[model samples]
Target chain A: MANDNGDDARILRLSEQDNVVVLIQSVPAGERLRLDGQELVMAAGLDLGHKLALRAVPAGETIVKYGAPIGSATADISFGAHVHTHNMKSEYIANYSEDDPYEAEDGS
Target chain B: MINSYLRQDGRKGIRNVVVVAYLVECGHHVARKIAQPFEDREEHDVHVIGFPGCFPNAYADRMMRALTTHPNVGAALLVSLGCESFDGQGLKAHVQASGRPGELMIIQRDGGTRSTVEAGRAWVEEALTTLQGTPRVDMKPNELVVGTICGGSDATSGLTANPAMGRAFDMLVDLGAACIFEETGELIGCEQYMADRAVTPELGQAIVDSVAKAHRHYHTLGHASISVGNAFGGLTTIEEKSMGAYAKSGSAPISGLLKPGDIPPKGGLYLLDMVPDGDVRFGFPSINDTEEIGELIACGAHVVMFSTGRGSVVGSAISPVIKVCANPETFELLWDDMDIDAGRILQGEASLEEVGKEIRNNVLAVAQGTLTNSEDLGHQEFCMKYKRFEPIGPECLPA
Candidate 1:
């Protein structure tokens, strides 16, 4: 079983070159945890398998994971904040979500 | 280490299956009814595979011919609705020429659905009886052809199941078995990494170009091949999902690039280009997981490995499918459907190498006739679609 408490939740830093870490369990927003001798609080509630910023990243900077550039940050992200679609975009292609109004066109 | 049967073409198979294939969508119901009785039979392996396209196509024709004559097949019963355009007789002749028993029943000429189903069922019954005489042969590990794919993937897929496949693939290659990794659309972010692993510089360039083509296809279609389930499972973008998907290929040097239905001449490791050639005008941008599995079987994969995080429980018609679960939580929910719990790595109970060895042992056991979960559950899922591709160039191969 996984621990859900902020300080006890496990996270994996995949590579030495990566700037994001993946949470092994869900952690709530406002829960404080320590990493690299710095105390940081979760910026938002996140579930298992979600990534979080390991350090501050500015807008348009590359977000590295698995030692590769997965995407670029869309805004400045502080340490321990959830890093996902709102803050990042892929370099190769655009994402198509079913909920996006721009993509859902009526077929005749 | 396998107790297999040798085909006239010299390929070996672990199962002597009787395939009842429908030439068009209209023939599907009758074909299914014909194949239904033997689905759960202990010794009889009768399954349905078909091309649903009514229009005649070279791609579909080739797929059907290759599949009907596949080594795992002992006999085939081709079903036709009597007017759609797939060369039913030509395919039957092709199968017979390849030294396999082939029979056709056209609904229009054979007294419609009721009579055709009755006749087809009778033919399948006799074929199964004849297949009982298929000679068993000793097959070595070097003769195995294995393929890998990841579907219904989530974050743990890359972390656990996919990388475990990578290690298993590496071990298979070292043991002189041919291994294939496909779905170039899922390899979007790691093109350069794949290119760098190619045995020859020319093959590397071809690898990169293929990924670029996939990039354009999805760009033109406005669909990134990422599913709603993937996003909900916490895959943030196509690139992120792709990075996870790429790990299934392991770290072996890529020996060649192949199109659908093209068997690898001699495979150390081969990258199968799943997207069709040319722009969006001629064909579809990408296909689903089950369709990709059909292509792998067409490429001569004796068995296939499928890794999943959100969970997929499909098995192919010709070969057994080994399902590796990525999420320990998902495993708890779908334990009866999975073969191996690769999620143990994510749960800190097992190392990747340990699971990789487990996968390798499972493959050998499966080759030696151990039933996978899907096989025991009778999940013989199969699908194929129409698509065009120019043959791969010589430069795309290692030799």
Candidate 2:
């Protein structure tokens, strides 16, 4: 699927098993998109290359990408809502905060 | 068909580079200064690569030998501080035995930094003249080894550049070329999937175990390889980035496992285990992208295909690096540094198969001595630090 311009591009679904679709271009809040014959509205401004939930996800549910669980949502995520670190947490390592030093512990 | 410089060990090199290596931190300045004058010249290509530790390590010694005698290298100059525990003489001897010109310059014996730099420059000039007479032979595609590493990955990486890289890797493997994809720590989430693609069930188990080892090692350090930059770029977790990074391997059955500097016996796909064996004494397996690229070079890769979503402008000292841009936005911002626009796959201007073909053609052009963007920009970045490892087991190399 080729998109001629960023203003009219569609979201990309990587796999049939993936629970989220990635935006090919940034979309502003209130923009309406149709997928699988159903209309969905962007709840917030989403940046390019960011993931949008394909369906409503309950709090604590795992967010799947590339057909594998990447992290769990911290709160209920609605369709077309951006899925990122602010709403999801890694199952492996804790996310870095502003208080942490930027360098690795060993300091190279 | 490509005409390449034929080394004594029945290997062909696309470029005849003279590398000046420093054995310790003290000698790095001298080595760099010696290479500075030749860097701007077109006829003579001089590169500086070295280890900074004063402590003796077998792994470092082996890596030094492998790099100096690499198929693409025709001559070597070893710079050493007087009291460092590294075996500078042994490395020089190995290079000479490979039918390449090798020389050693000790800082203290040569009257300190200024004199040693002057003396090393003189040696390199003579070495370049000697390398000019080296014979060239017809190099086949099967005679080449190619490697891939992903950096600055983002959400677009998994969709565009990496899978396109997989397609290129699959094509190379089909042509009997030795292809490698590495960073076991980055392969944390895809271990089981990777194991299933191994040539042998035993090798598959070994793949799984290696990732398990990396998991435990990183846990003790209280940090994963996932960086804050990765999070900012839309990668929320290590597993998320791993699924993208693992795509560079393509669908070929893994032929064997390799440690740093262990050359593959035959042509196929291989995995370079970057994590240290025994305990995690080296801090992190690789401090940056250059270390990973360095290990790939030591393992005999003639060229590296580096996929970047956020845009990395670094290259290597020994082999050429082809940068494949993953994000269309980043490509727009850094077009000069990128060689291929796999990001076009996202823009709808190109298909994955089309970008894959572009990468394959670029690889052939680079193997035929065309300079990649990184090479043209004079980005000869190199780094190798102290690291400990045990030799590979018989099971690791089943071929």
Candidate 3:
């Protein structure tokens, strides 16, 4: 029962405890979002293939993708503040952790 | 109903090919000349396959031997430049050992190009007549090995085409046929999940370690972004892309993990690690689609199931590639280029089982000698580059 206009928009649950829903299609600013059969006004524009917060998130919280924890957030993120590189960091070993002494010494 | 052209080795080939193989690129002209004589034959089975390098290496020798004696090949004419590092005589002997007729037409010793061409033509003509006389047999679906790969992927790849191939792979594996899915670089993040689905715990660890090896290989080489399409389609990290790419393997228990050129031990899900084991040189793992197909053939694949959202047109020298288009829009744009429209799954026009059934049917038909789009277009491109692979660890091959 998702609608693009001012009508009720259906929200999708990516995971059981995930406090977010993915915007299957684009949603304009000020449009009302129907989440868990409850209506919540959109705080901002949401693009397709992007996620939106289902509930208010605290500063330094976890962000998930594909129903798995991708990384944590740095600052207090609004219900839909585009959880991305600016907010989340990789849990996998990458360039961000390039300064470890063990890595530098192993030199493999 | 399943008609197959039987080869001399008692193996049935989907196609009977008069393989015109050049020992080295130097002898390519003579090989082409040999193939010209049988250009208009009823079987229409002239294919040009060769290695450009004249280097001595076990990998190269093994690859050439496999290609020359591939299932689709019924007869061969090896055109050598008379002084190359490739073991031309050994190739001929191997071909002869398989009971298929093979002749070494040395360009330097056979009076140069023109004479070699004529002599090559005579050789091919004789080989063809002998091959034509081989009896046709009935090939069963269980005896086939179908490998799948997805290149030029985009957003729709996972939702439509990849899952569609997974459904088909499930059907193929259930029928007692072997199925292979590869490109370890593409399968980065889902390693743990995939390994957990392995038939044995040891295989699961191997799957995880294989991706770890690939991550290290690509990271060290600084070409980690070879998966550019995923980023273009809005994937942020390698793990995200890996999660998506791993779906192509379906929900089947991975029977084994294999490196490039290693055939599946038995028919089940196999992961072919496309990245080189150490140091990661050789320019790029695969220059294009044909190189991937060449590697699949080297690993004993009779046919490959190619899934693509962006669409691909290349095929292999010894195997028929069944292109499965993942995007409905791409399929609409390139319908002729694709063999199966997996995009229909998204439109609700076709169920996952329907497309899966179609892919399985197409595999059987192709194995029975139906030419695919790549084959019809004469895309006989081949490339096998140099690389060193430490044998896959015991965990990877827990039989």
Candidate 4:
């Protein structure tokens, strides 16, 4: 279980191998966070439940979470950057789009 | 000790319900009207479940048969539209063979909706009276089969509700109960890890092959199972969603693999392979949550534990559903529909073990005759559609 701090902790790291930590609460841009005894400032406003990079990840590298690969980075990402669709893509399937060829008539 | 209705097949039921099923969409309205009177009556537990497809599908027939003879159902009233392709007679025969009262009402021959509804109601009333004298038997935890499915999932799901469900499943399996977790499409990336937990190497390979089949089928369809709501909830990729969804299985060893309607032969943890075999004839494995719930009940699940981050309120037609809310915000908005506040783990108020214990207790309470949140609100959502699958090999269910 993740630590239960009253208001001091704002992020949760699921595993030691994970390169990202999930935010428990939203943080405003420019807010300084002292996570794992390391000080870092938010480059942008982070939404609640979103991921923040725990370390620098280069382009084409797999993003690890829960001790497994979730996806690969599309571009070089710095430490503390938000790790989402803009920087990563699925390793198993191609990126999704509305006009893809496999679109069914029922649109399931 | 828990008291349950004893079926002639030697299975025990948590609820003695009279199910009114429609063979096609044409008979759905008549079946609903027949069940309307018993909906408000506490003594009579009548539910409406059906397949709406006009085309004949063997999988649909099998599921209907499984549901009609389900331990929870004491009697069945099947409604048929004379022109539809569904096998109403076969379903009726199968139900009767299970030693339960079965009746079929044809709307076209019974003089349209009004006359058919009147006749169907009378038959159901008689069935309910016969069901009232069912013998009660002591139920052991080993005789119970439980299933878990996650819906409307968000990031908090992996952190709280899903893992807590995993803990509860582990506890159930430890108590010599049969537990099942399903939806292969949602389990994309974790195939290798799942296979590693199998009791036998052959079963492990079968688990791997099932996920591979799902990958190809979904790839050809040009869409992953990850929905737009999932993306908005901060899930970035299919693998992320898969990992979260896989947590509901907990740390139990995989005892066997089962296709839809295949009852587990023993007390242990099993995986329901929802992905169809052969070509992709069916557009999707499941159209929605209710379809999967229907399949779980077909496999003899007495209770379903549904974990949701976006707050789903659907209860199954035959089996009872216990809702576990993952998101603290969603829990605040839909407290009336939620049974356990697993979001308390996210809010730092409770541990995952505590929530898991709550879920275990709730499962036993529901089996002992407590109406779930959705049941109290009269939410008996059900759906069935056409699909095909090859039979499982001996390796998939090794002795």
By lDDT, the best candidate is 4
Greater DockQ among 2 and 4 belongs to: 4
* Candidate 2 local Cα displacement, residue A24, angstroms: 2.0
- For DockQ, the strongest prediction is 4
The digit string of per-residue lDDT tens for model 2 on B1-399 reads: 878999887789988999999999999999999999998876337999998998888888989999999999999999998899999889989998998999999999989989999999999999999988989899988989999999987768888899899889989898889998999988887776677889998888888777776776676678777787766666777777888888788878899988899998888999999887766677888899999999999999999999998999999998999999999889999999999998887776786678888998899999998999888888889988877776788888786
**Residue-level lDDT tens digits of model 4 in B173-292:** 998889999988889878877889999999998998788777777877887867777776678887888988898998889999999999999989999998877767778888899999
Q: Give one digit per residue, the lDDT tens place, for model 1 in B1-399.
A: 588988777778888999999999999999999998887797538989999988767778888888898878889999999999999999999988888889989999999889998899899989988888888999988888898999987768888898889889999999988899998877877787777889988998899878877777776777666776666666777777887888788778899998878888875899999887754554454467889998888888889999998899988898889999999989999999999999887665776788999999999999888889988899999888777677789988767
**Separate DockQ for every predicted complex:** 0.19, 0.22, 0.15, 0.24
Could you tell me the C-alpha RMSD of candidate 1 in Å?
5.7
Over A21-61, each residue of candidate 4 has an lDDT whose tens digit, in order, gives 77767789999886655678888897766887888999999
Give the lDDT of residue B9 in candidate 2. Answer: 76
Model 2 chain A, poorest ten-residue lDDT window?
A94-103
Winner by TM-score between candidate 4 and candidate 1: 4
Structural similarity to truth (TM-score) of each candidate: 0.85, 0.86, 0.82, 0.87
Measured with C-alpha atoms, the lDDT of residue B20 in candidate 4 is 97
Residue lDDT tens for model 2, A1-108: 323322234676665577787777677899887655466788877766678788888889988887677789999998767888878877754222223322223311
Instruction: Summing lDDT over every window of 10 consecutive residues in candidate 2 chain B, give the lowest-scoring window.
Output: B228-237
Q: Considering summed lDDT, which 10 consecutive residues are worst modelled in model 3 chain B?
A: B225-234
Q: Using DockQ, rank the candidates from best to worst.
A: 4, 2, 1, 3
lDDT: the better of candidates 2 and 4 = 4
